[model samples]
Target: MTMTSPVALTERQCTLIARALAEPRRYQILKEIAGQGGSVACACMQQKHEVTPATLSHHMKELENAGLIEIVREGKFATLVLKRETLDAYLRELASL
Candidate 1:
């Protein structure tokens, strides 16, 4: 599959990305997802931060909306994975700016 460039993200998506990076814990969450060898479970993401489940859910939503993370549901379980290429492209865009 062809990967999408971060420059393709819309204004709303860019806002979501900025919001996600603004929170330290959310930033850590992204790191953890990247470090994980396999697809991370959404439930597992909660264990990485000290925040409440509600807050974790909110962060997940922001990351998803930002297109930085992709969620796939298998039966009752949801997996979260970092879109590293997209993230790299985003950082590259910022670097060029």
Candidate 2:
């Protein structure tokens, strides 16, 4: 696999992504979201991961800031969706290394 063009990722974006994935739990959370099809309810993730609401919220925010996930909120419910292109670009960069 080849890495995407350097222009596709700024140094700051790469750093943010790396930081977001540095934590094991955060990485797992990302994987879970990716595996859950198009999108998943935060409540469902809470049940699956057995984490407190606040903890899950923190993880989600980290992923969102890294551009790895997108969240859509409707009133009290929030749905989490994986940003496949960002993850794919990151993986391609890793493969290039």
Please report the candidate that would top TM-score against the real structure.
Answer: 2
Q: Write the per-residue lDDT of candidate 2 for residues 1-97, one digit (tens) a residue.
A: 9886533666788889999999999998887887878588988889988878898899999999999999999999999999888887787777777
Candidate 2, pairs of clashing residues: none
Give the per-residue lDDT digits (tens) of candidate 1, residues 10-51: 556667788888988778888888888636898887666778
Global lDDT of each candidate? 0.79, 0.86
TM-score of each: 0.79, 0.85
C-alpha positional error of residue 57 in candidate 1 after TM-score superposition, expressed in Å:
0.7
User: What is the clash count of model 2?
Assistant: 0
Total backbone collisions for each predicted model: 0, 0
Task: Give me the candidate number with maximum lDDT.
Answer: 2
- The pairs that clash in candidate 1 are none
Cα lDDT of model 2 overall? 0.86
